[model samples]
Target: MTIEWKGVMPAVTTKFTDQDTLDLQMFEVNINAQIEAGVHGIILGGTLGEASTLSDEEKRILVKTTVNIVKNKVPVIINIAEQTTKGAIEAARKAEEDGASGLMMLPPMRYKAGDRETVIYFKEVAKSTHLPIMIYNNPVDYKIEVTLDMFEELLAFDNIKAVKESTRDISNVTRIKNRFGDRLKILSGVDTLALESLLMGADGWVAGLVDAFPAETVAIYELQKAGKIKEAIAIYRWFLPLLELDINPKLVQNIKLAEVATGIGTENVRAPRLPLVGEERKTVLKVIENGLKTRPELPDYKNSDLM
Candidate 1:
């Protein structure tokens, strides 16, 4: 499957039934909705997808299900969050075996390996699969920056083709472009920074809240790419308050709540995580509600675009 890899590719959340099993039916519904909304790709088993909490079997199932449902509409990229090189290699191989078109790999989780260990981990995993890889560089949350020097080392692996630029340092976007040029596809990983990152040359957005509001997320990206900067900024300014929700630790719960409000998915999440409550829940709901009340109309946006 060929994916443009240059528009909104949501790091979709994993849906669960009340009993906490993977909600395959609802998951299919969510994936189909995203495809209808003109998303350039779909990434499963992301942090937002509750990867760290899901069983290995469940992760593979998510990959296989998405590949089948997506068909050739767009790339199905699976996120691998293992703590060991061997584990990451195994995860990448599993994703490829299940017919995934690409992988979004994080550095070794929980252990915070330094530069040498991190680069080695990515290289080893890249060798194990033929799928194109997007190295997730979220130093703000992951605590290990894949510095430009580190990326220089990664350049040896031809399959290491993209960077999820979530350093939260907006300058990194330009830095990556300056250092690597077209060697890497820089995708903005933070929702609040999506517009800025794009303005600075990010090729796409690996969005979090788009799971709830796919059309708006995609519309902003399309507007910006079309050189309609004023229209894009207008939509992005209105989106900023809600977009901030994706950067917090509670993002999973917060985004799922927005999904529930938007009618795309449920707010149910796995344990060690809980549903939003009290003021936290109310505040997030108000943002979604207020946005819906005054949601901007996309130029040439249509109901059929969502079919």
Candidate 2:
């Protein structure tokens, strides 16, 4: 299937209340806001969404809510990474039934797999669902590398159509583009590498900061696509500090902080992922303050609403 995935696909967060119940309204509100802001697509239950912490029922709700809100206005990619192939496949089936446009899958974590084993894990999921697969190579979180060779092996499966390259290496991105450019779509997953990814050869970006700054990310990407290189770079530079800050394991906290400071989602993330406080809060605030200082004077962007 030819799934046209492109532009800013936010790995959107699942909003939670102070009592830790899912704030479905806030989540839908943000999804609507992101769609209205011109996001190309949405990837629910990814790292930014705190997928690792959510229960299966919560995930179903998140996906169902997103599909209902988006209404096929754009593609929806659901990240399904579990310890067992069966669980991942089950989730993918449910996501397709719930109306996800495709599935982004990561191999089982903690227990590292060899090349053959990794391929087997994904191939099992690929066979289970008709939804397109986005092979996720997130070495930091999963501790397993989906190497170029492993990718080539996975590509033999009819459903594995794309990849989310989170390794943050531009050369590797170039290599993948050169090799599999014709066969599969490659999405840049690292926020800091979004610009370089586009410039180097990535088809799109799965942006974490899009939770708060969809316009900036989409604008830079659209600018470059339109061949306005200088304009794109200007925005890229303006966005670097914000992007760099997202690489922190405290990404959920940082994005929520941006959401709270600006007029986006709440600063409330689920526990284990606490709201920033003490020096951490001060550090994030300083970074944001400095980022805003260098940010271009776009009219109405820095208005009282975002403040």
| TM-score of decoy 2 | 0.93
- Candidate 1, which ten residues in sequence have the lowest lDDT sum? 298-307
Error of 1 at 132 (Å): 0.8
CA-RMSD of model 1: 2.3
In model 2, which runs have C-alpha deviations exceeding 4 angstroms?
A: 297-307
Candidate 2 lDDT score at position 150: 86
Could you say which candidate leads in TM-score?
Answer: 1
TM-score computed on alpha carbons, candidate 1: 0.96
lDDT of 2 at 147: 90
lDDT for each residue of candidate 2 in 153-237, tens digit (9 for 90 to 100): 8889978887888986789877887888758787899998888888887888899887877778777777777666787888888
Give the root-mean-square deviation of each candidate in angstroms.
2.3, 4.1
